[model samples]
Target: MRPVPAKAVTTSARKLADALRSGAQVVVLEVGREAGEGPEPRNSYLAGHLPGARFVSFEEDLVGPRTGSSGNSPLPRASGLQDRLRRWGVDDDSTVVVHTRQNPAVATRAWWTLRWAGVEDVRYLHGGLSGWRRIGGALDTDVPPPGAGSATVRPGSLPLLTAEEAGRLAASGHLIDARAAQAYRGDPDRTGTGHIPGAHSIPGADNFTGGELRDAAALTALYAAHLDGDEVGAYCGGGVSATTTVLALASLGVEAALYPGSWSAWITDPTRPIATGARPCGRTAAERPSAG
Candidate 1:
C-alpha cells in the first residue's frame, strides 16, 4: 500500500477503521496506566478497541527516569526504540496508531517519542481509547507479545534538540510552551514560572473536552489565533503534556512541531533566560492569569 500522508486525530476511530480496511499493517498501541494498577484497558478500550491493539505502560515502558539531566521524557535511545518497534512487527512502512486512557497527553508523548526514533507513519487515536468506546468500537485487554521483525530508522527521523538547540530556538521564538496559562505564568510551582526567554504560551489542554477534539472550525480558529501557522514548537514541563497540542494541530490537518525537552530542559541551564507573569510576545492568556 502506498503510504498516505500523516493521519489526523479527529474522528480517529473511523480513520483507524479505514486504515485497517485499507489492509495496511497497523500496530495499535495502548498507553497503560501507572504502576500497581491492574492491566485493565481504559474505559475507552474496554468498551471497544479498533482490533489488534497492544498495550504499553506509560510510566514503566515510556518514561525512563527523572534524573535532572537529559530530555524530560529522556527518550530511551533510538536503538531501544528500534528494538521495540521491531518486536512489535513495525517495519519502515508500518502505520502505528497510539491510544491512551482518555487523555491525549500520554499518547502524544509516545507519538513524539516514535517520531524521535524515525517513525513517520505515526498517529494518535483522537479522544483516545475512550473516544473509540464512545463510538461503540471494539476493545482487547490482552495484548500479544511483540512479533518477530526488526526495523531500522532513517537518519534525522529523531530530529530532537539538545538543551542548546532548545535554548537557541527558544530565544528565536520558534519554541512555544504548550502548558496551561497558569503554569506558563509560574502559577504552578513545578519550576520557573515564565517561559523560555522568547517562548510563547500555547497550552495543550485547549485541544479537547470530554475526550473529544474540538470541532474543525474551532481548531482552525484556535491555531490561527495562537500559532498563525508559523514555525511552531510545543512543549510542557517534561514534554509529555505539550504533545497534546501537537496532536490537536495534527488532527486539524495542520503541521506543528514539538520541542520534546520543553520547560524542564530550559530550566536545566541556570543561565537560560526565563519569563513569567503573563503571555510573552503580546499574546493574552488563553485562560486565567498565571500567578507569577
Candidate 2:
C-alpha cells in the first residue's frame, strides 16, 4: 500500500481511537520483551489497551534460534511465521500496526519483517506504547483469541547484508554504525564493541525530541550532517538497533537501506577486519586525531 504517505501514518493512540470510532478494521500489534503467560495478552493489554491490540513477544514473535551468533535475527521459517500470523488474525487486507517499548530499533525490525512477509500497510506507532500512555490513551484488558482463516504468506527478498556487502559499504563511504560511542570503539567491557570498518556512528536516539519524533526538517538536518554524501546503510549490534536509524532516514525521505546482519554478523565472519579504540572525525584506522 506504499504506507499511506509518511505524513498519514497514524500514532498509537490516534490509530486505535480511529479504529474504534471509525471501525477502520485495523489490527493493533504490540511487541514486548517477552510473551505473556496464557493467550490473554499481558501487562500492556491489561493496563488499558487500545480496543483491539494483540500482544506478541520479541523473542517468540520477532526472531528464531541464535544460530551460534552467525546471524542477527535469523528469521523464523516461512511456514512457521505464516502460521503464527494466521493465528494472530492477520490477513491480506489487515492494516497491521506494530508497537514496541520505545526501542525504535527493535520496532523497525518488526515493521521490516512484516513488510518482507508481503504484509502491506504496516506502520510503527511513533514513540511506541509508552508514548501512547503518556498521552492518556484508552486501553482494554480483553484478549481476543486468534480468528479462523489461514494467512498465506509469500516471503520477499530478505534485506539482510553479508560480509562482502559490508566491505563494499565500507569502501564506498556508505556504512553507518548506529551504536553508542562507548560501544562503537570496541569498548572491552561491552559484549560487542567496534563498528564496521569505514562506518561512522549516527546514534538512532538523535531522531527524537521530547520523547517523540523530531520534525522532518530536523531529521533532514541531522542526517545531512552525519551522512557525508554517501548512500546510508545502517547497522547495530545485531541489526535490531540499526533499524531505528533506517526509520529515521525514512522519516527524512532518505534512501537508506538496513544491514540486517549488522555487527553481529560482521564479527562472526572472522575474515572481516575489526578496528578498535576511538578515532576522531575524518580519521580512519592508524590515522591519529589532529590536535588542532
Candidate 3:
C-alpha cells in the first residue's frame, strides 16, 4: 500500500510494469559494483536485460575520481551528471527506477543522487531484474537509442556532510557507520577498518532480507531504538551503502546527511583516531574534525 511506505522505494514489480505500460515518462537504470563480486552484473544486461533499461556504471556515472582522501565511490560532479542525465533522457519530471543484481546499495546510490540533483520522482526497483522477470516482465537485448533530454541539474536538494562535518556528527550528533558489524568492530581481515570514533554501527544488510527492504513499521522500530538525536548522518565503506541507510531514515520521516568519503577517506589520514568494538563513544560535544 502506498508503495511500501517509503517515498524512495517501489515494492511491487508488477505495479512498476503497469507504470511502464501506461507510458509515465519512466526510465529504468541498471547499476552494479565497478570491480564486481565476480563477473560484473552489466554483462548480464549486455546479454539481455529489462526492455528500455540503460546501464549506469557505478564507477563512471555515479562516482567521481578518487582525489585526496576521496573514497571509492564519492559523489560525481553535477555537470557530468547533467550531461549523463540528458543522454539517459532524464528530465525534471522523469520517473527514474534504479536497480542492481547484487544488492540494493547501487540502486539506492543512484536514487539518492538523482534526488540530490533535484529530480522529484526517483524510486528504487523493489527486487531488481530477478523480481522483474518473476512478474512476467519482458527483457530485451537491443540497446535503445539515447533520448535527447534537456534536464539541467540543480544540486543540494539533500543534505551533505564533508569529512569535517561527519566527524562532528559522530561525536556531537548521531553518526551511523553503515557497514558490516565486523567492519564496524575492526575486523582483522579488512585492512585499516574500525569505524570512526563516536559513530554507531548499523549494518546496511539489516535493512533488507533476501533482496526486499523490511516494512515501514519494522524499520521505524529498528531505527527508533538507536536514534534519538537532533541530527543524524551516515557513511559506509565508500558512499554506496550509506544511501540504504539514508533511504531507511527517509522511510521513518528522518533526514540524514551523507558522508561521501566515508571510511575510505577517514583512513587516509593516518593521524585520525579509530574506534574498535561495538560500543559507540556517546559523547555530547566531541570536537569537530579540522580541515588539513
Query: Alpha-carbon error at 282 in model 1, in Å?
Result: 9.9
- Score every model by TM-score: 0.78, 0.82, 0.89
Task: Write down the TM-score for model 1.
Answer: 0.78
Higher-ranked by TM-score: 2 or 3: 3
Q: How big is the RMSD of model 2?
A: 5.0
Candidate 1 residue-wise lDDT, 70-108, digit = tens: 556766655666777787778777788887775677787
Q: Encode model 3's per-residue lDDT on 1-292: one tens digit a residue.
A: 0112336555468878888788867888888664554486578778878888898888889887778788777778999999999999998888888888878888899989988898877877888878887888898998878878878798998789998888887778888889998778874334466788888888988888766777888887777755564688899998888999988887666788899889888889877767666787521122323334
Kindly list the per-residue Cα lDDT of model 2 for residues 1-292, writing each as its tens digit: 0112353333556656657688777777877663443364356556666557777777787686777655667666678788878878888777887876546656677877776677766777876777777767766778778865355777763354566776677667567787787677874333334666677777777766644567778877777755455655778777777776766666655556667667777777555666656652233234433445
Native-vs-model 2 lDDT? 0.66
TM-score of 3: 0.89
Ranking by TM-score: 3, 2, 1
Q: What is the lDDT of candidate 1?
A: 0.66
In TM-score terms, candidate 2 sits at 0.82
Indicate the residue-level lDDT of 109 in model 3: 92
Task: Provide the clashing-pair count of each candidate structure.
Answer: 9, 4, 0
